[model samples]
Target: MGELKLMKGNEAVAEAAIRVGTDAYFGYPITPQSEIIEYLMAEKPHERTGMVVLQAESEVAAINMVYGAAGAGKKVMTSSSSPGISLKQEGISYMAGAELPCVLVNVVRGGPGLGTIQPSQADYFQSVKGGGHGDYKMIVLAPASVQEMYDFVETSYDLAFQYRTPVLILTDGVIGQMMEKVEVSEQKPRWTDEEIAKNTPWATFGKKKDRERNIITSLDLDSARMEQHNHHLMRKYEEIKEKEVRFEKINCEDADYLLVAYGSSARISQKAIDLCAEKGIKVGLLRPITLFPFPEKEINEMADKVKGILSVEMNAGQMVEDILLAVKGKVPVEHFGRMGGIIHSPQEVVEALEQKIIGG
Candidate 1:
């Protein structure tokens, strides 16, 4: 077993990054997630693993720093809450367009503009859809517990490098601030310069004598070349969708209704499912772990059996659209949520299912 410790989700992410041999982290502090940077600073991982942790002047600067380090084949990460994440979108799009690998953590807060410090799942559209200009998609992982926060840093980096694409850890402030026991992983050594060169031949780690110079940029002036690149990216995305869709199902085989959710909402929905069983409703749950590569195939299969589907979220009906698409109207799809940092309760979810799907 791994070493265990009680920690907040944000702190777990920081510790996990250090344990996973992350080369560098550049980020600006923000509410509900400042603990990420705070933990790193307090731990002083520079001395421990030679991991560089810098609090940049702003969120924009921090994301660009990630772009620079990732371009050179280093394991880099950055974290911010909702507003701060908005600042980093262009950089994220740039990294995606350049086909660079990096891990990004968004511990989401409620917001259209500085709405609240409380948790939210409102960033669903932004994380999975291309938030910035151009056609792009980020591999989004939603962690429901502190243990997942600790575990997903390495997982995000692994997927990032494996596909040469940016990956997002899309959690919220509830998990970010909540304390729980985590089985921390053993520390891994950072990659050497030689190892980096050998593993990432496409990286611009200075001009190598054995290969052609690699230039890292998203800009392609020629229309034909840009179109070709877009097609290539689409193919990669299709491959990811086929191979990486991840979800968890509970009591699904005998469900009369289904609850679709992710992140903190998934945790709540689990309890809701239990409540439903006690009421003899026989509801099941489908919680997406990878929000981008959604478990569409599973959802589609369930459509034929379930009477209805309810998307329980912290935002106004963002993920329900995807559920609707997946079901293709075979079952009624409805959304139940509380907005502006308000977390809906298990009872509320049960009521919503009864009213919106079961009766409506």
Candidate 2:
């Protein structure tokens, strides 16, 4: 363990990126997440760790910088808010098409168009199901707390390298702005240059000694080949869904109602769980750590035993759809949420649960 310290979620993510030996960072300033770029700028890791940090003129340029660095087989990352992330969707889809490994952080705010600086999980579908004009997916990790912001960054980077794909840390402004105590882990995975050379044959660096002229590209002109590429991407998604699903079960062993939530909304949902407990209405919270590869099997199993499920989210009903699919009509599934800069209070969540579980 390094040391326990109180830090904001965005700052924690910046520190984690440096500790993980990220080669480069390219991003634009955005509300709530601007602290991330500011922290890196103030720290000047280039002098200490030989990392490159550049503030691009636009989110599109920043993500393209990520694309260029990733093409060279470097650990690269970018951070932005909702509208900014929306602008970077083209680069993200291109990275997915090229099968480049990189990490992307989206500290979400209210969306649609310059919605608000307040916390919102409106980008849930965008992060999971490729928001851009393409058929692709990114390995999405949802951090409910500041600690997860630190730990999951490293995990996200590792998963990106393992799958040769992009990994997204889907966070909200609430988590980004909240100050919390976190332990920065000292232990980290070691990837030597030789190992990287052995693993990444597709990297577009000068082919030293090795005669293979590798080209890093996403364009497949042949329609049949593009169809094959789509199939390959789908297979990778299936593998990730089966192997990478992560979630936390709370008192689910004998609960009447299951509460499905993730990211900052789940933090508020905890209070609702306590309240339901006082009322003798057994409730369990299912917090999805890996939002893209959701714990569908676990949710389906819980649905069989529980009376119904209530999805509490900051968005209207993004996660609720996934929950409904998991249950697949086995039991009733309801949604309670607040959007456009408003987040539900604990009592509100409890009220939703009470109405859904008791009244219905």
- Which candidate number would show the highest lDDT if scored against the true structure? 1
Which residue segments of model 1 deviate by more than 4 Å? none
- What shift in Å separates residue 259 of candidate 1 from its native position after superposition? 0.1
The true-structure Cα RMSD of candidate 1 reads 0.7
Model 1, range 313-357, lDDT digits (tens) per residue? 999889999999999989889999999999999999999999999
lDDT of the candidates, in the order given: 0.94, 0.90
Query: Ten residues in a row with the worst lDDT in model 2?
Result: 187-196
Q: Give candidate 1's error at residue 254 in angstroms.
A: 0.3
lDDT of 1 at 57: 99
Candidate 2 per-residue C-alpha lDDT over 82-125 given as tens digits, one digit per residue, 9 for 90 to 100: 99999999999999999999999999999789999998999998
Question: What TM-score, to 2 decimals, does candidate 2 have?
Answer: 0.97
Backbone clashes for every candidate come to 0, 0
What TM-score fits each model? 0.99, 0.97
Clashing pairs in 2: none
